[model samples]
Target: MQPSLLTSNASHRQYRGPITTAIFDWAGTVLDFGCIAPVEAFRQVFSDAGVPITIAEARAPMGAAKREHIALILKEADVQARWQAHTGHASNEADVDALYKEFLRVDEINVAKYADLIPGALDTIAHLRARGIAVGSTTGYPREVMKNLIPLAAERNYKPDFVSTVSDVARGRPFPDMILANALALATPDVRGAVVVDDSPTGLLAGLASGMWAVGIAASGNEVGLSLAEWTALSPAEQQAHLTPARAKLERTGAHFVIDTIADLPAVIDAIEALLAAGERP
Candidate 1:
């Protein structure tokens, strides 16, 4: 028999109670939908290193620890070819190291300026909190960057019960390390009860692999310069033309549900509640 796509049985080996916590990804999921700061900073860093990468390309490493993310991009198949094409230079570990430092500095300084709470983000968070659901935040950003944003996020009336960094955990997305950490921090004993909301495919896989509810918020205004609907409306060929890299990620890490904005979270919550009512997993 074919395996059921929606029902999670194996991953959630330990049957637990309903989900009472929600794990939120920082950049595209909550704070800023477009991820303006890191994307622009990475582009500049790459340009300075003689390899000009677009903001879209720079976001490939998102949802993973900073160093691991950097390594992924530096070792990408097109690393040498793209570098040669854009900058007429060959990139090595030393070049990657220099780019890393510049990117970090720019990220630290620029993150604050890019803080736009995604539409309905704060409202959804508030709604969950009011319902006694604990909200926790985890990001591929290092501690410095997360700490820098706390004050800003607080000013906007959105605060996470636990704020953690990717470095705080052993591994990053596509592995359940960060989600596990957030679960522990939130004291959520049941995986089914916790919801993981993210915009990255890796992040969605991480949550799903951890047996938590994964909600993919494919929001518009991505630094990639196209709205989510705009990207989706194109012909399959056109869509593939624009999102080859992102599509590769998605194909590898399929999400349970795809949504265009945080505004659509009510439907997600309704589904989770229904699952709970049915006693399927949660």
Candidate 2:
């Protein structure tokens, strides 16, 4: 006999009721409508180095840590060729480090230019707070950049309880570190009772990896590459073209929901709560 190993039932505690906390990504999701800061900074830094990467290339690695993002861009075939042609050598770690240093200098001054709180962010955050849902934020930006962006956001009436950044943890997006840092700082009793809302695939992936529900922003974020007014000005058919693919991209990241902007977040929150009450786990 195997000592009746199957006789004992394993039991574990779980939370099933309502979302107690919500974690948001900064740019594109809440503060910056189109996630413009990093993109502009990336493009400027590359151009200054004489590599001159295109906007599409600048945006392709939107949610990664800044230095890692630069490295990813350097790995691209087109960018690599351009770098070699311009510098007489293939891009290397030192080039990445140099570009990243420039990016820090540029973005620290540039982020404020795009810091307008996305329309409805304040209201949506207020709605969550009203229901006793603790709000926290995470970002791909480093601490110094966040120090600039956070106050700009606060002045606009949106302030998250805890702010986590790439610089605060060893790894950033597509990793669970920052989101888990938020969970810890916000003191979410159970990770399952938390929801993460972001505008990038990497950010959403990080949330799911942390065992939390993940939501994505489609039309208002990097995927669509448009501000609120620019998005609204598009013809429905035109809007559909960019939006369908953007939504699909986020869905491919395994998000629990995808909405156009943070404005639509409260409804998603309600839907998630309904599922939670039904004993669902993200």
Per-model TM-score on C-alpha atoms: 0.80, 0.95
Q: For model 1, what is the C-alpha lDDT against the true structure?
A: 0.72
> Mind giving the per-residue lDDT tens digits that candidate 1 earns over 103-137?
88888777887776777887888788778889987
| Alpha-carbon RMSD, each predicted model | 6.1, 2.1
Candidate topping lDDT? 2
**CA lDDT for candidate 2:** 0.90
Residue 208 of model 1: what lDDT? 87
- For 31-92, candidate 2 gives per-residue lDDT tens digits of 77788889999999999988898889999998999999999999999999989988899888
lDDT of 2 at 110: 80
Q: Best TM-score goes to which candidate?
A: 2
Task: Name the lDDT value of residue 217 in candidate 2.
Answer: 93
Weakest lDDT window of 10 consecutive positions for candidate 2? 5-14
